[model samples]
Target: MQTRTALSLVAIAALTACASQPMRAPFSQADLPAAVQVPAGHTVVMETAAAGDITYQCRAKKDMAGQFEWVFVGPDAGLKDRSGKVIGKYYGPPATWENNDGSKVTATQLAVAPNGAANIPLQLVKANPAMGMGAMQGVSYIQRVATVSGIAPASTCAKANEGANQLVRYTADYIFYKAM
Candidate 1:
């Protein structure tokens, strides 16, 4: 029984170590679905898990019958690897990547899909070389995929929460690609 317990503890420790390391694997570009377009010469360099909120603020839409509605402004999330080290962050102007090494890149949307029953969309993102370095050095694109959860309540447009910030929890995979 003592030997069995020792082995179990070792197994658990190994799993924990594997779960806490940063992921720097090369992902196959071909694995990307047709919806995610890789720019010419770009290849997937790293893939991280993003767990955070899609922030919303109640605002008066220009054409929504004078009623306020929840508008998706941006994401406030932490980016982690399979090993669980925080590699970056997502926030600002619809989409952005800020790495731990002080590299930051804002992306332009190339393709998007209506994700599910929710009204929000999933996106294919591209970054500029001039915008980042270090961990994000040379990164040219990212695909937001494998989304499991994260969408704001449609009922939040009510007067009670008007002009206030709301955070909708979500999780997704962020695959980073670089120009090779």
Candidate 2:
């Protein structure tokens, strides 16, 4: 019947429209803590889900003899796209993000807010000028949000444990933005 064919065409057209539109980001800055929110005039250029471990070492607390604590060493993570394909890596003492194209960026911490008692804090960082080119070019800011379980070990850090290292598992969403 003509009516049935018309309805089928309408459905096909609707699906085509949706397929052609760019995908929207899964995150919303308005729902995030203010300290970690990216400033206006920037638009998301890339978003990645990072999974890996943070290394910490037990060391004497600064300015406080006879006390010890866990100090952050660095992070090592594989960055994945929304559908779970590894696109890059995140690592370093200098905190670097590198894409498959060999482009990279190192950023300075701007601010942080508590995520939860059992998780690492959400963070915002101002990106330094990118190195190389490709995906990292023009990146202005990077926000670490939706953190899970990156906190330092809760075990006692005593003189006996000095210099001992621990690797804590964590996952987070790293969203990179560029000036619009």
Candidate 3:
């Protein structure tokens, strides 16, 4: 019993320590790939570790035009920081970002690469026009990196489960960039 208590305390202390540190820039401007270009004079302002689910709704095949018999639509999820703070959210085809402080940025996919079978495709997202005065203020671009475990479960799309909302949990690094 005492050992268990000690272990729990240690874990809490570790989480608190991690949460206290300020977020850091993900990478230097020069390091950004051409597809992830930020405006001239812009640089990475903040980077947060996002841990959350990527919700998917199974849908039936539409005319059998694609290889997969069924399709999954959505990546909607609330995002959290390393210390487990609800900092933001992500959603939609024109993927959007909304932070706790009400900052919002709608993004367009500029590039993507497969991370893993159980992870959503990592992407470079360009902000339409970063708005608000919160953690996302002045943000012009975002990169979804180090993604894991958020892939849509295609197998769940059995005909009977069509239109069902399923959530696939995932984690990733979300780097925000802004004009200096």
Candidate 4:
């Protein structure tokens, strides 16, 4: 009986181990979806995730109150899943440059990687949609002043492309827009 019990325990342990084994995150950076057409003066910066996903950022303006938050002009920002469904939109609280209190940038869309993950660990947030159902994601847009040190990454580290602010850490996929 003792031997039987030991065998069962071993089997349970093995199953537990298998369940917890980590897999390399399965996300990859694809070309930006075609629907997202930044104007002639705009450029998109892609942030590659080690696991296989990409994030994007855009240039934006601050409101008169010194906060720059999305007011949802028409619809929430939209994103497509790998299978090409309009999976979800990106939302977050207001942000600003590290100083001066008013340079705000908002996340407009997220690729909505499956399994509620970014292919890596990330700081996340979201809002309540009508039914109290909402979505969240790793931030794709962020704001920083030219004076804010360390927004750029060092060239040699494994995660050299990552940055940390007083509030969050993320890899930036930037989009620079200019007028034609």
**Candidate with best lDDT:** 2
Model 3 lDDT, residue 35, Cα: 58
Q: Report, for every candidate in turn, its global Cα lDDT versus the true structure.
A: 0.78, 0.95, 0.72, 0.29
Runs of candidate 1 with Cα error greater than 4 angstroms are 1-33, 118-120, 130-132
- Candidate 3: lDDT of 16? 100
What's the lDDT for residue 141 in model 4?
A: 38
Candidate 3 C-alpha lDDT tens digits along 49-97:
7766666777656676432333445566677765568787877656777
lDDT of 2 by residue, 1-180 (tens): 999999999999999998998987556799888988999999998889999999999999999999999999999999997778999999998999999999999999999999999999999999999999799999999999999998999999999999999999999999999999
The regions of model 3 sitting more than 4 angstroms off are 1-41, 65-70, 81-85, 92-94, 154-156
The alpha-carbon deviation from the true structure for residue 134 of candidate 3, after best TM-score superposition, in angstroms, is 3.0
Model 4, span 88-177: residue lDDT tens: 332233321111122223443423222223222122212112222222222233211111111222222222222211221232222322
* Cα shift from native, residue 86, model 2 (Å): 0.5
Candidate 4 positional error at 120, Å: 7.9
Off by over 4 Å in 4: 1-30, 40-92, 97-117, 120-169
Q: Number of clashing pairs, model 2?
A: 0
Q: Cα miss at 82, model 4 (Å)? A: 29
